[model samples]
Target: MGRILLFNKPFGVICQFSQDGLHPTLADYIPVPEFYPAGRLDTDSEGLLVLTDDGQLQHRITDPKHKLPKTYWVQVEGVPDSAALDALRAGVLLKDGMTQPAGAALIDTPPGLWPRTPPVRARKAIPTSWLELTIREGKNRQVRRMTAAVGFPTLRLIRYRIGAWTLDGLDQGTWKMNT
Candidate 1:
């Protein structure tokens, strides 16, 4: 058992603690010292991020061998039809490799979702839709790539859950020490 901190990371916040001199870093939001992010969420992405003080625990959370499931709420440029959804469920091939089977489904906009500061790009002609996507692997830009492969590019991506931990009750830019 070690110190675990669950943070609702805001979009545009860099995952690292040190200042990048261009964007806000974890240090801006998290004042706690000696804790590091268990895994990375891209600066363009938002939502749940787990941090820990124990090195072994961090390894467990980040190691792909653990197959820890991560879920995201994705807003895409186009409405995903059954075919697109099926493709996501089966596994979509990316430049890196074929992704593992994922859990994908259409979902309404998440309740109580905080609006992104710089808002996602929008088009008056194309209507957007939401999807709940869960994946076991932590490939680089996998979710956005997955949606793009299926012809529905992701406009906004927010990580909702990682393993047993979730973003529930965690507000953007805030963190809490898990008991």
Candidate 2:
């Protein structure tokens, strides 16, 4: 029988089980053996990471051909104007290639948001804003690059959902098993 685990990965934690010397890893939080992450989240990012013992299920979630829509709440260094939002929705050019069109919008602070440790750097002169972005492709540092391409650098990124799964009730560094 296949099993699934939804993990709420905290910021600064590595996704891998191996030790990297300074940062904590999934091994510290998830005690389950043989389960592998369906996808990866950078150490700087925070939110849901789906893990499963089934290879096929992992492929579906991470494979480009499946196009599983992933949603993120991004905090950026500057407020995006309509043109910028349009650019994002229309797909921004990246070093890898032009990204697929994404669902992009400016949003107020996310409700029930947890504060990041050592909170984002603030500048009284430079303003920050939140954006909700959904994309089907997973590229390296894609969200950060996308925001930076449109004149706003990502300050913090939180993956809120992957297809039907969400970070809903999971707190930071917690995991729940789905049998």
Candidate 3:
């Protein structure tokens, strides 16, 4: 059987196993050998990152053609109304091309959410709101771009789930092997 691992990758931590010549990587947390990340979350973003030893599993999760949904909790700079939500659900045209239609809705703050380090800048006049967005494709910075396109710039992004797996009890920089 292949080993499967779920890690809550914190902000500023690279998803790669080694950071010998770069910033902090998975090596700083998980000690498991021969396992690799199923997908990548940028260092500026935080959330669930799955690792596995099976090559096919990695391909299945990372390939956009598979249409596996990745859910994110995003805090945007302004409150989005029904029309904005509709636009996000329909699909947002980006410089890379038009993104696939996504599943999006306003969401309450998740329980036990950790404060991000070097926290996001606050705006006195502008209020922020959270939204749950599930996208089938993982284009570079797609969530941030989509929210921005709808007049609500993203202040922070946390991916909470991928397919059937989720961060669940995993804390920042912590890993659990369940396979």
Candidate 4:
């Protein structure tokens, strides 16, 4: 086993340790050195990010062949119907290709959820809903693309779990060494 760190990444923060001169980078939140993110979370997304000092462990967490499940708490622009949920479960086709079938279900907004800075855009007329979506593949913007393809574009995306790790006790912009 190697040193493992679980970080609660904030939105608008880049995943890299180096400064980007624009958005805040991981360096701003985590001071630890020599640890690199095992996988990536987009600049617009938030939540659990795993970092490690071990190359083999990073590869295992990131390689698609390992198929570690990633779960997200997604807030979409509109309520998804059964058909939409089924589409997500069956796999949605994207410009890149068909995504692997995913686990999708309607979920109430997670308890103890931290509010996103510059909160998600709200239209009083169009209602929003949350879904717990889990995917085994890590395609670029796959979750957002899948929801958009299903006609309920994602308004907010927060990764809640990755494999056996989760954001349970971690707070936004904080990190902890995995015991």
Using all chains and alpha carbons, the TM-scores for the candidates as numbered come to 0.99, 0.97, 0.96, 0.99
User: Could you give the candidate ranking by TM-score, starting with the highest?
Assistant: 4, 1, 2, 3
Q: Supply the global lDDT for candidate 1.
A: 0.95
- For model 2, the stretches where C-alpha displacement exceeds 4 angstroms are none
lDDT of all the models against the reference? 0.95, 0.94, 0.90, 0.96
Better of 1 and 2 by TM-score: 1
- Highest lDDT against the true fold, candidate: 4
Off by over 4 Å in 4: none
Q: Candidate 1, residues 67-122: lDDT per residue as tens digits? A: 99999999999899999999999999999899998999999999999999898888
- How many clashing residue pairs, candidate 1? 0
Q: Tell me, what's the RMSD of every candidate? A: 0.6, 1.0, 1.2, 0.5
Question: TM-score of the candidate numbered 1?
Answer: 0.99
Model 4 lDDT tens row, 35-58: 999999999999999999999999
Please, what are the lDDT tens digits per residue for candidate 3 over residues 51-143? Answer: 999999888879978888999999999899999999999999999899888999998877899999979899899988999999999888999
Off by over 4 Å in 1: none
- Cα-lDDT of candidate 3: 0.90
**Clashing residue pairs in candidate 3, if any?**
none
Report the candidate with higher lDDT, 2 versus 4: 4
